[model samples]
Target: MGETRREMKQSESLQASLPEDIALKIASFLPVGDLCALGSCSRFWREFCGSDVLWESLTRQRWPSLNFSTESSSVDHGDSSSLEGWRDLYVKWHAKMPEAMLVVQHVNQCAVSGSLDIRDFLKAIKHLNSMGLGFKDVEMFLLRPEVNVLLNLVGLHYCVHCLKVPAEHVMEALRNSKISQREVCVKWWNLGRLLFNGFGMRDESHCRLVSLQDLALPQDNQVLAVIHRGQFTRSFASRYPYSILLVLPGLSRSSQVCD
Candidate 1:
């Protein structure tokens, strides 16, 4: 009789079932990549991926790069196969009710080695704007101008682990990146890395974000600007002589870019 009662309880629990709405809420918070993987887990996830909210979320995630369908033609992405792979993955997850990502990812740093034209710069921004996935795993190759725009749109509060580029490029990039945000922080910008050439002063908005951790900058005038403006102390500024330092006149000399 006890066994029968236990079996009845199990049967009742199975009959009640979990609600679809709860399942969807759980899936929405998962990263897009994870969703894509989960979409293949079984038929159940494929349906969840079809949700419009997910596509909207993905669209917001990859913006500017994948913001609109028309601008897509201009993207100088390498390898048609890769494009298809990303698309296929998108389709596998959200193809039923198509949407786009806010930023594009895996842009090759090697691609922007020689020239830093506005056309190229804009295209790079467009690319980053199209990345529909989260920024956690993807590595990007940005020109100085695009980097500025990236900082503005992605918000200075973003979680970035690295900011690599050449010395000259950082100067121009920092100059032009002064549009909308503040608080500067760069991480692991190598000594030899280069930035785009024609960057103007960035918006005042960059003043709020502060200090990059593990920053590796070149020793040059650009570094001086970043230092003088950022008000890096004599000790900190001495370390990075080449990379650009944005000015945040309000912060104390003791505050740091890496901390």
Candidate 2:
């Protein structure tokens, strides 16, 4: 215990001799972990290492893509005037990245399979939620081009029309997304139009019915028989683009349109 105390005192004396400006300058070059460790020495060291300049440098080094000034403004990131802002942002981003990559990899695998499997996708969502990433993290993950491309391919564009997928798969995705029901309903409608109009599909009954159900409002199941064979005329289809929207009263006019 005596020797340890002597060593600690010697270390503290050496660090104390360095000018504060020089100490902060040197800290800027240290890795985040080293800076964190150095902060444990004393209150002065903790305050010195917790400067915004040092944490900003560390944050940029760790995540080069983050434009802290602009992106931080859009989110409710507390205390941008201090090091807490950069430190907290980096911690959240770093913690979420691994799980986000895992989600991308799973979606890519599904894309490769050329089918939308509800069980597999639901399993991915469950794993993502288990990782403690909240709705904001999931939203950011979807914005990533690498993840978004794979998701669009397997989730909407190709897989929606693939014979290997069924209405149940789309319904399951809608149920598990954790986003707004209206967003999920719009996604299904967009996929159905892409599959039917752009790709020359003769049937959209299953996709449309699943989309209507995604509205989450009670609807007449008897309507299923009305469109079971997708026999609605072009005029009716154009006039009533989405029967689901009729039941939703508070949404804006623009939100109701699939376009």
Candidate 3:
């Protein structure tokens, strides 16, 4: 009984000495496990540590590309009947992070082995989709420096080198990639000599979805001329007549040059 009273008095003194904002700032620096433990100390600390604002900041810091505004707003407006608080959301996402990381690891392993499994790559895409991510969100996530490198390497191997993965699968992944397209194209362009040396254009569909503009600098006209004269074929030229005319010096839309 005496010890309980003493502990209560100590907690009360600490609460009185520390302003709520200062306490929250200090608490924000705590690891998730430490923060949860602190919340168990008392009702005041529990509510303080579980503030949606605090948890929302933490969640965003951990997953910058993810949007939790809807969930956070619902919790803030006392709509707990439908949506969970940011703390709960953070815990849920944190718990599932390992699964997401495992998918990334699987992709990394495939890239390292120089044999990308379209199934594993598709699994990663499916996982992102299951998380309620749209194409733009997926593109942003894939653009993270670490992820971008792995994605490009795997793409080059599967799409150009091995040529094992199907064109549809490649297109599916590309649809979710925007900035990463340039690196993949540059890689493919560099390996053009290899393709010309022997491989030839066995499957034109493999690169049909690739953006020609991404293959070189916007001002570099050589890429368009090379595509026009290289293995891209007349159909390829006709399909990108606008892009060709924009880059190629002598070509005009009225010239019927692409035709």
User: Which one wins by TM-score: 1 or 2?
Assistant: 2
Instruction: Give the root-mean-square deviation of each candidate in angstroms.
Output: 14.9, 17.0, 14.5
Worst 10 residues of 3 by lDDT: 240-249
* CA lDDT, candidate 3, residue 217: 29
Off by over 4 Å in 1: 1-16, 64-211, 214-259
The sequence of per-residue lDDT tens digits that candidate 2 reaches over residues 182-234 is 32222122223445446754444323313333332224333333222233312
lDDT of 1 at 140: 34
Q: How does model 3 fare in lDDT?
A: 0.49
**What are the Cα lDDT values of the candidates?**
0.39, 0.47, 0.49
Q: How accurate locally is residue 71 in candidate 1, as Cα lDDT from 0 to 100?
A: 33
For residue 7, model 3's alpha carbon misses the true position, in angstroms, by 4.3
Best by lDDT: 3
Q: Which segments of candidate 3 are over 4 A away from where they belong?
A: 1-4, 101-259
**69-185 per-residue lDDT for model 3 (tens digits):** 776666644554755678888777766644545556766665453333334544555555456432223333443344644454333232322223333444455544543343322
